[model samples]
Target chain A: MTSEQPDWIAVDWGTSHVRAWAMTNAGKIIAENGSAKGMGSLAKDEFEPALLELVEPWLSAQTTVVACGMVGARQGWKEAPYAEVPCLPFDGKTTKVETHDSRLDVHLLSGLSQMKPADVMRGEETQIAGFIAAEPDFDGVVCLPGTHTKWARISAKEVVSFQTFMSGELFACLSNHSVLRHSVAGKAWNDETFETAINDAISHPEKLAGRLFSLRADSLLHDLGNAEARARLSGLLIGAEIAAARPYWLGMDIAIIGADTLSGLYSRALELQGCAPRCPDAENLTLAGLAAAYLTLKETSS
Target chain B: MTSEQPDWIAVDWGTSHVRAWAMTNAGKIIAENGSAKGMGSLAKDEFEPALLELVEPWLSAQTTVVACGMVGARQGWKEAPYAEVPCLPFDGKTTKVETHDSRLDVHLLSGLSQMKPADVMRGEETQIAGFIAAEPDFDGVVCLPGTHTKWARISAKEVVSFQTFMSGELFACLSNHSVLRHSVAGKAWNDETFETAINDAISHPEKLAGRLFSLRADSLLHDLGNAEARARLSGLLIGAEIAAARPYWLGMDIAIIGADTLSGLYSRALELQGCAPRCPDAENLTLAGLAAAYLTLKETSS
Candidate 1:
């Protein structure tokens, strides 16, 4: 807990975890904490207590709290609703929640949605807002890799369109539940093997179904190393994603916002295809985006 | 239990279950039984007891038992090494296991392996053998759809080469373990929806990564029914498989051997691609193959 009282609080609550930050008036983070209590685990009435438990020390009389991510989802504390595409990432359109405690004023940020592709994103929109906030002139495709990676086209301070890929989730499911689980049971990796697999998948995306079983077969037949099998599995899934997302990244300025390890793999795959991508720290962007939303809430109230 | 003693026992011991049939000297089934005691659950020493528990009433003095499937795998009861491809599915090669009871005389059949692409199959080999035993001139591709679907190119009573696809397992993994689990719950299926998704995946296999997420997005945004989602998920995976296995099925006589529901889906998907594949009952073929192996054992012993 921080000695100084927080002027406001910023929260990024997602599916599996909740993260909070105690911010000063000038957007300085005085303290930070997180818990496994995420949207997926909590009930509608339990959100307030879960949040309060994490940041009670920083609370004061009439302190305003601005939250983003799944906290604003339909099944969340309050449905902030989705602001469709061709709109700014954060345009002061937030859902204000009526808390029982007089000192607690909670506001949830709206996520972005696309109608044509039938795609929707929560939490990621906040990260995009932060990326745009940091580089106002950044106009290109922004790829946010996670359980479900999102690729959004940003132009003129608005999201033109976006697509979502479940490659990360597919990788996890296949490596854990499928027959390949026994072959790729370790965290070890082989870069050369990964590169080869990426090329194979990119060239023949149709063969992905057939190629997946080869990992297990090779392990059983020629003693294919667990690391190589692991790397190849990752490469195959990511390569297929890159192949499907060609229109988004081909001959376009690109920025990849994700964790170092995953972003690095994406960077390597793209670089193999002769494209360079700028990678930004994901956590910092989330914090920056939440702070931006907090500033907007303060302005509207004043 | 049957009053008459069995001459031999035909067992299809796979990963999840052990099925045994008491056979007469003239290939007549007197009784049939199975248990959850699959090769996956039994240790090397425990396989004898599991087999005895199921066939104790049928066993007599020196009862010959012919077993196939994962029972011959390296980790199974006895290691019956894989017989390389371009060879007969089950020739005269069989691994004999020493049992504690003198009444039990057991032999495990060999699976097939492909060296170039590094593929292997255990239980499906017996099915292929059965297919060949029934139709002695099946000089084309034999598709066995299951947890791990196998596509074997047959030529002149030999398995020239083969490939394995995890589409079935992939479908199970994605629907049960991935984020799509929430959207694709239940068994309701829409044929029209399935057909459309099949064509989409077959045409643009590269776009599969992008299309998968749409199932979830459509469910969330447009109320895509669980039935439609389930069918679409199955279609996309099976379609991708058909696209990948095109080289094996193109212009070649195709035969699908599996359970009714799964084989029907594969047949439907292939029919959309202008190919008519023969659907054979998987159980009858397994028994025929095991009987063939038993006959070979009797001849060699005599």
Candidate 2:
């Protein structure tokens, strides 16, 4: 019942959403689909039956399935052990799960972790590998910005380590839901204000972490324009993260991987941090990571 | 038909809620009456009718009507302009609300304002006065912690100037409501861990803004004990707020105004900042403010 045509599905599952790519052997994405049904939305047993139906057509060709995201954590199937720092993706080991249906070969990737002021990342691992696929054998850090912005150090075929920032989430909360929410002018981006905030934040970086009341007063009393206040808020937070990542990233080459809209903020932040940005098509990169995992599995079995 | 004996009432009026107190001049509170009648619930015109009915019984006697919170704002009735810094209660010229009903000689007191780094406060002006009532008028800073915490520099009867912090609101949104809420430990009051976070945040103060994510990962990766992580998170944020407030508050005596449960956090934070904390009862400080306003009105007319 299987078509001789080979099929591989690559999934970048995250906190809020999931994206799966159907790719050919040469790693060209022929057909694709996505679902709002993110990892957070699913219970442990739901991923298999749900995933099979979406990738069913390609699966008739004996497709191998690969996955990433919180879908790969302790809450995830198989309890993939935390990968230690400076470790590579699929570092000759994978968290393999044999689901209800055996026809699908499923591989869930491992999350990366670091120590003492420690951090870990799950969905970003494949994105890092995908970037590696686009520009093979590249060295440096890959920055992904979001609710949990991620930074990964990559060398050879492995991600040496990475850090995560709850930047996007904090930004959303501070802007819309908190008491300071009413005090700010929302949804408008001004670079001058943003840059000024970044400079002020970097200059008096400690103030970046202070209670947000001064931010409101600055706008109200000091007549800090709304746009500048907004940018300053954004800058103080992002600048603080950059300050933390500096010890790990200084003097290293950096590539920012993610969609254009998603990664633009990180790009601006990189410039402020004296690093140039490289935007990789996240869709293709995830497929590339799946391809790497599938091929690694195939070669090891052979 | 009017009752001659004094009765007690407690009033808690805010932007969204309106309350009235009918009380004896003695500390003991008697009967209380209030309605959904908050400032937001009615138009500006409905205030007179609503307020009259709230304490109709006490109007015939020498009953003193004590009001607190936002009921005395410029928008409430006759606009009360702000008193400048360093002036105590009854010191500044207050704008009186002269209504046709002679029974209600509403003594609208002046709020406080500062010109440099310009800021203004209305209800808190009374709270500051109440705080002063509870303690000797010392040259110090009094912190009123809530959704928007006010840190004021007071000299004698005057609130020289103050800064606002949206600390409580930010903490609520980030903890119980935001996505990061789930990741936070379910424990409270880990002073040791909180102290560590304070030290870490103060040392690399820039990272103070970025330390939130560490709370989640420190637990997930290296088993960062729950209470410690929670405390650390609190310390980091409180430390940052203190750091920012330090510029405005250093060298001034600092007192904290809050109920016991909530004020302890602020006290611990002040301790972290190496500032001894003086906490007076926030009990009916609002009513105390209303009483002060009434007394000032009587003395001024005499």
Candidate 3:
């Protein structure tokens, strides 16, 4: 471990994983670490030790920690109440966590929730806050694709409304657990198959169930290869999601925040839908979100 | 172990289990037995042993054994090639298996497959054939709900056309494997939830992806009960299937051949859609279909 003391710590704790970044006061990253101990694995008391296990090498006697995501959920380190929409992703407030280590000061950022449509997001709100932090005056839709893909409308630096889709989860379950598993067992990308399936799904979204079973039947009757099956499966799901999310991205300035391959696929899908979306790295946005929270904590303390 | 010689044996061998019925010369079932030995678990050579393991007690010096479902699949006891649609479910011709035991004469019936829309059914075809045997002049839509539900058009003793939906499989996968698992872990059926979800899904089928995640979020935010979650999951899937199969079931005489609860659910959904379908016991239909095949075999031999 380096002898140089860190300025503060930024953490993104989710359901199945924890990621931390040690940073200088100026927001320059000094070190990065992570662990499989996510909120889902830890009890309320274990949250502190789980965090320290990963970032102890970089901690000082009295270092401040700014964390986002599920770690701030009701079941996390502490319940940082959600900032209800028609409001900023975070209302410039962080809940202070009581820690056993006298030297540790932790601030957990709250998430965002919507009532009318019944929606909620934990970690992604911080990422949205970070994106807005970079573009202070941004007003448009931000699409975050993941296990539970989210689409949110931002107007005047506040989230107006949002919707969540189980597209990624649906794709995984159908491909790995359903009858389609045998057909789409391997990785092979067929652009034509994907595009065709996507278009079909969008055109006739009601046929989704029938089309899903065809993948299995086609493999048995028509010798449909694994790649084509996989591509068609992905295309059908993404197409269905996009069809449902049309009101959010139709003829609007849109930005998608997600990982590499998934984001690329979303980008291509958007382009196919005649909307060229600006793509950004999801990890960067997460760190920037934690940095924003850290800066706010510092300002409040001073 | 009664010493009375059995006349014939009927089998409904599917992917997960095998059911057999020993009958008299008058087609009266004297004994019924089965085992976990499904087509999926047996190799070509093991199928004979699997069958013998269950029905050996009923075997005589010469016993006629007739089988249907996946047992006649390419991977089953023997390949009983599918009879093309616009034809009888079985063309009075069964694939005879060359058995090691001279006392056993086995005949496997073919399933029905449609080429235009690309669909196939193995075991369900036997159920349909049985229905046709009971109602020879019946001409309408037959709905068989199961792991892979089949909707078929029966006219003039032929399966004119058919479609398969993965509704049951979708429900199982989403409830057990997807993010919705936490929301719907146990059997808690709420009628209101099921009816409401079915109506909504049928009205706006595209919103399915969005509505699915809401189950999880609602459980987290609104404390949605597991019963409601389970009911809604089922409603959403079945509703989508009904919407897609509208062409088959709409304004037509519909008969549902399935197990008790699932068939009951389908009957309710159809009734909600303004169609009261006739509910038939799937087991009875299978046995009747086997009897029809047995009768045909005897006629040809005599």
Candidate 4:
């Protein structure tokens, strides 16, 4: 964006948390800060100001700002439309978000312009952009597993539609808060159990939805230890995701981006599905996308 | 069991809550009270005083008490032995409980006992006894569905053995507290969607566990409304329980117990399984069980 040594403010606003990074023109982190409070909390107006405080140290008279995530959704400050599949950085409409400080010209990055019956997403648009920046010529599929695990088929710089799975959220709720908690211990995972569940699920997918109750009975009837049960439950959920994401992953190389604990799970799961796994450095992609968005905005708006 | 009408105390103690019912000689309610503090709330000593206060208003020198539930568990006042299935009143041990009030003679009922792999229950034993009191000659399976649904096979006035399913608890936590909440709207049941999930589960029993992630995806893909999605999710869970409970249900008639709203739901599910449904009144069952336990104690002892 700015040719100056210190340029724009980069933010990744997620559902449960917010992460902000101040970057120099050369793409080095000037400063980084984060908060547990995310888009799920606060009124839309409170968002920009709260974020401003975190990057206040770096905010000068002309610092360009770009943000991604649910903060650009319908519930966000302004609804950023979805960018359609198979496109490059911030393919959707970018908005000039309101800021308390006029000196800080913030460019809220538009998400992907997804066209089906509707349009959606603000954050993943940036993520896809960053992925393209890092691997500009790559063409395949990327799976981002979380509350909603999104599997996108990417060709060149654009996302060619995608499928979303509720695997992560279901796993969390079923394991921790539901009766399955007694059956499945916790975060622990066992490979044997995982593989067994995957095979069981893949073979009889129609029964996959109903097997949740057996988690408890299986634990009580036999000693399906907590770790095995948890891993088995994970397999059951992610296996379902693989089924739903099949159309997206068909004939495509799959790259998974997440922390080691989470991405490793997907990698293992992908391997089971006979797909090769590509594990990328998440931080690098995020910064690359943010910088790319800033660069795009600088060129277009200048 | 007491020939003479003297004030009686009936208690249902469980892991986390304690409920006491004060009844007349003829089982008419004199008063009732409860406490959030349960066996889980205190050590052995603290139980007496806290329990005393909960029923202090009806406490008198002439009181003969028979208590049920976890008050007799390993964590309660003293470990009460379990009553084996085909549960009849007094099948369990009679543990003479000591208290600070010399005037009050409390006979804490025994928990349902299993000698083999060793599993038992305290409060549910009383509930089964109550069910028997309501339908003294009935023989089949009675399901007390809740956070833990207990299915007991009754014959010859003995319960044989019962299996507990954590159905309601799972349903509550998922609908109210989990990410699936966003995917599922409304709390009411939708028979069509529910039946689909149930059939899906039944068709492929093994994969039932894995299909759970489909709730959110189906919601997103298909235009099923949230209320229907919630009901379908619930049906998916309960169907799994039905599958697990298959052993206990074979050759046995089904009696579902709960408020009409909940019990009706179970009845419909039972119908789906081709089992006839009979719902005995639940409002009076707990108290009736206490009465049965009291009467049994009176007959065997002085």
Candidate 5:
């Protein structure tokens, strides 16, 4: 099997890029490929070519491709309608798109949407599925912090409820576009600054906006160092997010999934709030999710 | 007085623009002028030329130019050292800049600063001065809603203490630069939507970051209108601001000095919170502040 062509490809396609892994029938990663051509950049018809462009070398007859994330969005390759929650993160069925290449059988997984408080998430669901796959009966919270930080409550392998915070986007906008940009220096992290700011914001969430301006005022008047300002800015945003997500994470055993630094930051923030969350690499969870989908699809086909 | 050349000039120089009124010795506006060349755009030396270009026709020998706002900021035309608060908003002993044209005597007014909580206000202090000039015994909170909405405590004709909120800047950043930009349509505003969101935010201020994402989700799932989303965004920000500023405006008489629509929003939000704010035109207040400073300067010179 190692010498032969790969059995399938597992993909995590997001807004800005597509990452695919060639896999053996036994779910081993044979090889990995990626491209900047993501769902955001391509038209509906262009997705097939984009996928083939990245994974063509490893493709063979009946090489199934299971993709997740924005590729299944309404404006993406195909509108894989969302799976409304309080359900298993992965139901083992996905939306399939017609492929021009007969060698490929592509399935795009649907994202999850909540109706009550009104929330939706893409790509992260696959990561959640992967997380559940690892700990089959994991019953608590799984936090995925990224461009949109998600706090999901999982009970007996089902995502009970969740909330999303635009913390990452807010951080980007403030650091790059708002008046705080002047005060916030380069990408530097300070634990003490981050902790203090987080505590201040959490203790007085209403004063968040005022504290944001104080960053600029402090920089101007006290000549606050850029590193501290940058860290404090991150701390403030994350603190507000944690405050909002208290119901989800306060008493729950938690696992955090994302890039190393971000997950670490969330981990530390939660620790300050008295919860120590388990940290997991986001990419691994995404891969595990894609693999689960592919195996389920293979079982159904057989 | 209208026919004769003005005796002096009143200037409100902010980050992006400069507005000036040519005034008689008795504080009557004889003419008005403005230009996009504000403190933000001009270098230190270019400020004089920029000012001259706008009000050059009104200037004659010994015509004193009194300027306020960011023009006196460290990065502005010239640094007018801040006057520590619990003091008068303006002392009239301002930073004087040398001009190539002997016709102008430019006096830049200093802003007010609070050292304890670490806060500062530029153009707003001038507006507060104007508010004071109108009601010499004015005592209470003055709310100035703009890019940086300020809540200033005024008593005995002096600004005692103040705090600044990044509400307006947050609205702009989220609407134009974040993922929420996709859901928010044009510049449409809804009062009912604004009021409801304000109440909701005030009730649960900590959930602000989460509610922000709900606007995006509501658009995705429930087809939240662009107008409603826009208004709700404003409501959420203003709501959080009000909640934080409760201590200042809760039991005190309040006045809102700002642009028409923005001040109206703050006024309505405050009213909902049960404080009926006095709405005063921001420009009028700025003019009155400049006039007061001009009069003080005249008396000192005499």
Candidate 6:
């Protein structure tokens, strides 16, 4: 909506949504917009129109568009194959898209994959890059809590290895689709209950499946409140993830990069295990990561 | 429809479906029917009509209909309060429901509950009772694997204690709703892959959350087939359950009562841990349990 013309575009195109920011050549934001036309909802040819729907007003002459996330997936407009891990987050290796509009020069960033554990991440690599961009000398684990939470070991500005946990997706599925849906209906939370559940799950990770059904039993027999049930479910899921991820965060510097609410829970869970983690605002980091990619592309071309 | 009037009716009304059998006084089945009108689908007031719709043709004057399962839940036709465990699965403790039609005399069976660990079961109690009826000396553990799998310790024909696992529901939720849904799409299964996954999960129950995500990653990177992914998912979940229910099955007489496919999986998983479990057909046990309750009622009345 800005009257001034933009120099380039930055897009964080994920599975369910597409976020775009019109930025000056200096990385200063001019305007921003987003749409529900994410990679999941769009066909191969529809990506251009979906992108143009949001960034059309900011466009002038030929402008470079840099994007990250699932837009680089196989089903995306153009597949930006994953780069193996134990390398830099981003190094100007982007997949160029052939667009109909001459004013659009689109580039999708490469995601990172690990060969041994057989894991791959698309959007998170950008956030990790942004974190590295902000803290070049940062050496430790970067925990990104999200739909598929990622735990990456970073050393000397390089991603050594990473693991992904489907805790967020599992929470969504359990709360909305599974039998626990009836028990955890409300949005209310109990911190004490959460802590207790986390401790129980972390201490006895094997009992998790049985403990899950106990939520429904507690609701039926003991009148466990919906809020407490919700907290307990979250705590239990996060606790299990933490139990498995102990080796990654145990005795290492940890920074949790995500939204306040999820990050807060992760921070509290880590604190319970005698480790302190720094929570960084997720949006800023995503934008920073896109900008980092943009700056690299510009430098290489120049 | 049968020309002869039935002596009584046996019903297993669960969350999603209502199954009925027209039985003679001597427990001879004359006809059987089922409907989608489960306790979950019908309101309290509508339960009678739904029941009559399926059993009306089989009903005779003043027929006694004994039903089990979620039909006795709080939201069911009439709340059959849960009986605490350490007692027989069914001991003629039935909740009588007032019906509009004089021809219908409905008695809903009480489910079992455990207070300490907090667990409850509706229809599985009937299956356990049936198993005990067939093997009156079943002095070990009875495992009923279904939507909410139940593991009950049976001693002297009593359900001493029990635990419920949401592994079935978890499997349904993850394979149908989560990111893994895309990976595990076919009905195909691999026994070897399933066995390997079970061992992996049983050995390190803590790594379950991480392993779930790997299915998706493996599909993307290593061309993991849908059948292999599905089998692996099942193995991991059931293995975790076995790991937690070790106390219940280890060095004990184990009887698995459920549908053939699921019961077979539980049997195989238990066998992997050096336990030989007897797999019994679940339907026969339900009818046996109902007949047991019906006979007890008739004896008391006479």
Q: Per-residue lDDT of B54-158 in model 3, one digit per residue for the tens?
A: 889887678989998898877787898888889988789899999998878999988877787888899788888889988999989999999999999999988
In order, the Cα lDDT scores of the candidates are: 0.91, 0.69, 0.88, 0.71, 0.89, 0.92
lDDT of 6 by residue, A28-48 (tens): 888899999989989998999
Model 3 chain A: weakest 10-residue lDDT segment is A1-10
Per-residue accuracy of model 4 over B1-302 as CA lDDT, tens digit each:
23333468877777778887778768887667788887867898998788777866665465777777778876688877655544475563578888888767788887665444334455776777788877778778888776667777788778777666666776777677765677775656677888877776555554443355456445544555787878777777778777767777766877887667778767777788788878878757877888877777777776
Candidate 2 lDDT by residue in tens digits, B30-84: 5556777766556667766777777776666434454555556645655566666
Interface RMSD, prediction 1: 0.7
* lDDT (Cα) of model 6: 0.92
Off by over 4 Å in 2: A1-6, A101-103, A133-139, A155-157, A184-186, A209-211, A218-229, B1-10, B15-20, B26-28, B31-66, B70-122, B133-136, B183-188, B299-302
List the pairs of residues colliding in candidate 3. B188-B227
Which should have the higher TM-score, number 2 or number 5?
Answer: 5
Off by over 4 Å in 6: none
| DockQ of structure 6 | 0.90
**For candidate 1, lDDT tens digit of each residue in A1-302?**
57899898889999889999888888788999999999988899999899989988887778888889888887789888999998989878788999877789898999998888899999998989999999999889999988999999999879999999999989889888887889999789999999999999999887888899999999999999999999999999999999989999999899999989999999999999999998999989988898888888878778
| lDDT of predicted model 2 | 0.69
TM-score of every prediction relative to native: 0.98, 0.85, 0.96, 0.79, 0.96, 0.98
Score residue B28 of candidate 4 by CA lDDT: 84
What are the DockQ scores of the candidates, in order?
A: 0.90, 0.52, 0.80, 0.20, 0.82, 0.90
Q: lDDT score, residue A7, model 4?
A: 75
What does each candidate score in C-alpha RMSD? 1.2, 4.2, 1.8, 5.1, 2.1, 1.2
Per-prediction interface RMSD in Å: 0.7, 2.7, 0.9, 6.2, 0.8, 0.6
List the candidate numbers ranked by lDDT, top first: 6, 1, 5, 3, 4, 2
lDDT of 2 by residue, A1-302 (tens): 23444467777777677777776778777667778777777888888876776676666535577787788877665567677777676565677887877678888887778885588888777777767767677887788887888878788867777777777788788888764565566666678767766666666776654435556655545676666667767876777777777765688787777768757766787788787877767766667777787788778878
